[model samples]
Each structure stands twice: as C-alpha cells, then as structure tokens.
Target: MPDPCSAIVHPCLPQNIFPLFAPRPWTLNTLHIIHRRAALARLLNPSLRLHAITYSPFSTTPLHISTPALLVCLAHPCLLGFSPLPAHPITTWHCQSPQSPPSPSRPPCCHACSPAPPPQVPVERWEEAQFTWEPFHQWVMNTSVYRRAVHRNYPMSYPCGVWANHFYKFVFIRNRKAASTTVTDNFDKCHYENSDPRLCIEVVSLNRLKERGVDPAVMWRDYFVFTTSRNPWSRAGSSYDYCSTKWARTDGPCRQPPFSAFSRDPSILGKISNLFHCFDRVGMYHDYYHTEPVAPCITTETGLPAVDYIIRYENLSSDLPEAVRIINQRRDPSLPPLPEPKIYWKKKGQAARSHEEQGVESNTAALVGHGDKYHKCGMQCVRDIYEYFRVDFELFKIPLPEADPAGDR
Candidate 1:
C-alpha cells in the first residue's frame, strides 16, 4: 500500500524522520515527538466534525475529532486513511486477548516498550460471567428502577453506538463511546473488526433496550449489554486535556478552565439541565457530554442500573476480554484475539501545553498530568468527584483511593 503518511506528512514534516522517530504502524506516541519537531507546521485546523451534533437510528457514525490537526504533523487516525492508532502506553501489565501468547518478562528492546501482559487464560473464562450471563440479570431487569424508566421519556442527550444483526445473537449496545476511535480501533485487531458490518441501522438511546416497546429484560436476555467507567480523578484530568485542545469559547462546556477550579466546583460535575432549558444555548451539544453525572447518564430515569456489566477502565486488560469474547463468539470465535487493546492513553496532555505555552495558572499546570491531578488538587477535589459520581463508586463497588495517589505509590 502507498504510504498513507506520504501526502499528509509532506507539508508539515519530512518523510525520513517518520521511520527514525517511530517504527512502522505509527502511533500518537510518535505524534507527540512530531508535534515538538513541527511547531512551525501547526495547522490551525478543526474539521466540522469537531462540533457535530450527530444522531442516527443505527450506530457507526463518523468519528468526532476535536482538533483534527494540531501542531503535530502526525497522530490523527483520520490522516492515516482511517487507521487505528495504538492505545496509550500503560506503564506496566497491559496485554492482548487472553488467547495470545504471553509477552516476555520484558520487551526485548526499548522500542518494544508495551508493558507485558499476563499469561493467556482459557477462553471459557473470558466471559461466562458478563452482565447478560449474570445470575442477577433477572433481578436487575425486574428492579423498580428498570421498570419505571423503561417507557418514561428521559431526555435523549447522550450518544451511543449499536450493533444489531441476525447472526449476532447478543444485542450488545455499544455505549456513547461505542463508535469512538479508541474502542473501534481496539477491536480484535485479531479480527480487524471495529463496528459491526451491519452498520446501516440507526436508533437513538444509550438506554439500549428501553425503546423496543418490549420488556427490556426479556428482550436483552440473550444480549450481553454492558458499559465501562474510569476513575473519576483520571477521567477529570483527561476531560480537562481534551477540552483544552478544543477550547475556543470561555462561557461554554470544555471552555478550558483551570483544573483546581473545575474539579472542586459542584456545578461542573453535577450539571445536566434538560434540553428545553439548554436548547438555544450556544455550546449546548458539547456541554451535554461533559458535565453529566456518572450514574444518571448510564442508568434509567427512575435510577435503574441499565447495563449488565461495568468494565472498570483500570481493570480493562482483564475486563475487556468479556466484551471481546462474546462479540467474537457471535461472529467467528476462531479468529485471533485483538492485539494490545486500543484504549485512549496520552503520554502528554493538552492542558499542560496550554498552561506552559499560554502561561495558564501555576496551580493548573501542576495538576495537569493524570498522576499529578488528584494530589495536586488536594482532598476537596477528591471528595467532590467522589460525591459527584458517588453512585458509581457505590454501585460498581470501585473503592475510593486516598486523595493523593503518590502516597500509595
């Protein structure tokens, strides 16, 4: 195949440096280096997709990229003929599907820096325990929370991806982040499958089984419905960095505010006003995604747990396999498992750049990276995020860490 990078990289960077700085099948890790090298080549470009308020009955919508072309001459997947970039580098203990051979104790070379994964587990263990397969699946469906909100008209604000077809028995509703580049790319690179090929059908509702006008419990009995969550502290830092890159207006969501100020403020974490109130708002669509509470957004209006699984982001290497296993089982179980899961990891963040380049508040700069965020923000930030997403920690049973992670390390 022609070098996908040749045309795109030419204007901003030399072709030769690509091989030297990063290896074949390049990634954002390489993009960071390219950004530093091509400061003069920064293309002040933000494609219309950045602000797309897209909705469809079937999932598989176009990717929503915030800053399509930053100063970097590289890293945007769209630039590489829609290739998926590698997931962010985990410092240790990351891996491929449970079936793949275990990585060596350490990578043979520095270039092969991906953290080693645990030994492959038998495929039987990959999923038999997922949400749909849960013994409590019946109870979760019968609970008042699910029943009351099944037909009630909750505000349809969040985005979700879906894959429904004849052969695919389990009605897996890929949540709002479903069609996202990171998850899509991460699919069994083993299978080279991203969104399901039966993509044309589009229906709204991350509340997956509700709109079918049938009992969601029975309707979803076979499908392995599930969603994922991340640590609120890391989640917040990531949100800050993303918004900073897309930051344009001061009054709107993702307007790129100081981290210390943003995390502690209750309004930023808990605000999810109805559409009628925010309909005419300038950044209404963008704001809708940012500040909504963890539980409310994922559950039924009457406060029912909507999904069967909660794949905690921290436990992804172990958890993602459940989703991957079932999806493959539906299609072809014999396919090789995906390579290193493609999660959204950023070694450097845009907020630090904003603070460093634009001289943002000193406090904000100190709290920029994930490790720096919680400690630097202090106890108040931790308590606030915990309270904001209280149901998540409680229902999911995710333990709250001490305010500062540095102490634990």
Candidate 2:
C-alpha cells in the first residue's frame, strides 16, 4: 500500500482566502506566515493578483516565490482526511537577487497600434454645459401645482400663479409625416390617471377643423402646442412612397393610395398640396425650427400667449427638458413623459448611395409635375409654405436649404 500521506489532496482556494487555511506542515507558526503573505500580496496590488496554485504530497516545496513560481509537496492530512497537522516543514526564498528590480512585461505588437487607429479617450469624462429657455418651456412640466387634473371639456381651468384666470386646453394638429402622433401621445399622458380627459385632444388638421368655424382661440386656449417637419425633398419623397405603397397606413391618407382619384393623379405635387392643406404651422423636420414656429403656437397668433411649448423632431430628445420646463412653468406640474423621436428610415447611407448611383430624379414628372411643367408650380407651392411660417423656420436656426437657385422656370 502507498504511504498514508500519498492520498493527501490540495484543494484550490482563491489567493485572497489562502490565509484562512493553516499552512503545512500543519503548524501554528506557518499558518501565521501564510496569512501575512496573502495580506502583503493584496497590499501590493489590489486589482491584479495571481491565481492560486495546487500542491502535492510527492516532494518538498517553498512557501513563497515571485514570478510564476510554484511551491509543492507540502502534505497536510487535516486538509483532506480531517487530521489536525501538516506533514512537513516549508521554506520561502527570493528566486532572484534581493537588490534587483523586476523587468517590465513586454506586450505583443499587433493591429491595436496601427497608425490609423482611433484616438484613445479617457472614460467617465463629460462636458459641462448650461441651458437657457423662454417662458413656455421654462417651468411648466415640473411645477408641482400644475400636474393636477380637473374636469370640463375643451378647456379646463388652471389654478396657479398668473395663469389662474384662464382655462387651459390643447389641440394636436397632426400633419402627415410630421411626428404629430408622438406629440399627441405626450399630451395624452399629461393628466392624472388614465381616466382623466384633461390631457386628451382630437388630433385633426387645422384646415379640416377650421371649416367648422370653431374659434381657434376658444378651441386652443391655454394649452401647449406641438408639431414636427422634415426636409421638403425627403418629405415629398416619403409622401409619394407611402401613397403608392402598403406602408401608407402608418401615417399618410388611410383611404387607399389613390387619395387623388377624383381630383388628379396622386403625384408628388399632389402629396405636397395635401400636406399644405392639412395642418397649421407645419415646421421643418430636417432641422427643427421649434424656437420660432412652436413658440407662436404657445403664444397667441394675434401675438397673445396661447400655446405653451414646441419640440423640434430633429432635436426632440435634447429638446424634451425644455418642453417639460415650459409646460411645468405655465400650464401643469404633471407633464407626460416625452416620446422618443421616431425615425422613418435607418439605413440612410445605403439608400443615399443607391439613389446617387442610380441617378434617380426626385420628381417623377420632369420639370412639370414629375418633369418640367410641374416644376414651376412645385417651387411656388414650397415658397408659399415657407413664407407662411417664416418665423417658425427662422427661430429654429434651420436655414431652409436655399431654394433651387434657378427659380420657377
């Protein structure tokens, strides 16, 4: 039979916990040294440490040595067979000279150090910046007194500060492809509980509702106003694609693609015409012009303060705090959560490259509708829309892409 110590097993423990186990040859003094060694290693480097190594009963070994050194053959029956003592004496020694310092480790050179590699940026650093705001978005959403819900229909009376005398209400004038749905959702959440109708509004185009001869003021007093816009070219393109495809149901006219069946063929011009006739103060989407366009909506048109705040679709995420501030400041304390800005397309790079490579014309009608004849009318229509809401456009800091320099041919 083999020696009784032959079956001794050295169970692996984490290096940090090594001190807890008595050192062999199972003596009180060796155990004390083991604990001290672990503490010393930890103090040297808390973040990096050597994984513990195993021992065997076959041969003599040292207690400690640096630089990938291993100690072995110290037997202890108490560790495995429940014996109380170690089988041998253990010694420690420095493998290298006492006065010499260790050599630095050399890292393998590879693609990481390539010349065109991205610059190394330190983690956990952020730029400090400050924000300024107008009255509408300044304090509206967060003011505790305003978040309460009250009863009544179109306009609910608000009880707070200078706004206490007036009834507050809002209308979400949803324009096609103009992020109106997101606006509607945010307003819907502003009231207390799901049952409160204070935050709800029937979203329809201004033109459609105005025909009913409703007082625009009575219809939209004291409420926050919001809308969105896109680059005209992209908007026209999107309108055409939606009106011609199955995806039209998502935003555009829902009565089927042939929305112009009775009037005229649904061309790009028709789509733009439909959009112009649909909403009030439709702002540009490509560059958000909330500073000007939405401001007027919150303020009175005859220039009295009516609407509370506006959010640009392009910078909606960053612009949300502004909206909250305005709403909380003027209207209600309980502002609804802001909706994430919705993006229609994702692979813009591939789509743009393909469009460029294919040399696709924006308008199907040459210079006319899709071609030459439609070009003149298209240009005029675009200008009319711009002039109608120049204040909104100008304030948002988005310069309308300079109109085609040639003008209407």
Reference-based TM-score of each model? 0.42, 0.29
The list of candidate 1 runs beyond 4 A from truth reads 1-166, 171-180, 185-218, 249-255, 266-283, 300-304, 330-369, 401-409
lDDT of 1: 0.38
Best by TM-score: 1
Question: Could you give candidate 1's per-residue lDDT for residues 15-132 as a string of tens digits?
Answer: 3333432324322222322222222112212220111122211111222333323222244322211111111111222222344343444332222222322111111212222213
Backbone clash numbers for all candidates listed: 5, 44
Task: Output the lDDT of residue 112, model 1.
Answer: 23
Q: After superposition, how far is residue 388 of candidate 1 from its true place, in Å?
A: 1.5
Angstrom error of the Cα, residue 350, model 1: value is 5.0
Error of 1 at 357 (Å): 19
Model 1 alpha-carbon miss at residue 230, Å: 0.9
- Summarize candidate 2's per-residue lDDT along 1-409 as a digit string, tens digits: 4333233334422233332333333322222223323223333234323233333211112234322221223222111111111111111111222333333221121111111111111111100111123332222222223643421111111111011111233333333443445544454432336734443444233343466454443433223443344433333334443332322233454333332231122222323333443222332121112112232332222333222233333333334444444344444446553334343322222323355455753221111122221243455544543443454444333354456666642
lDDT of 2 at 102: 33
Q: Ten-residue segment with the worst summed lDDT in candidate 1?
A: 81-90
Looking at model 2, report the run of 10 residues with the lowest lDDT sum: 118-127
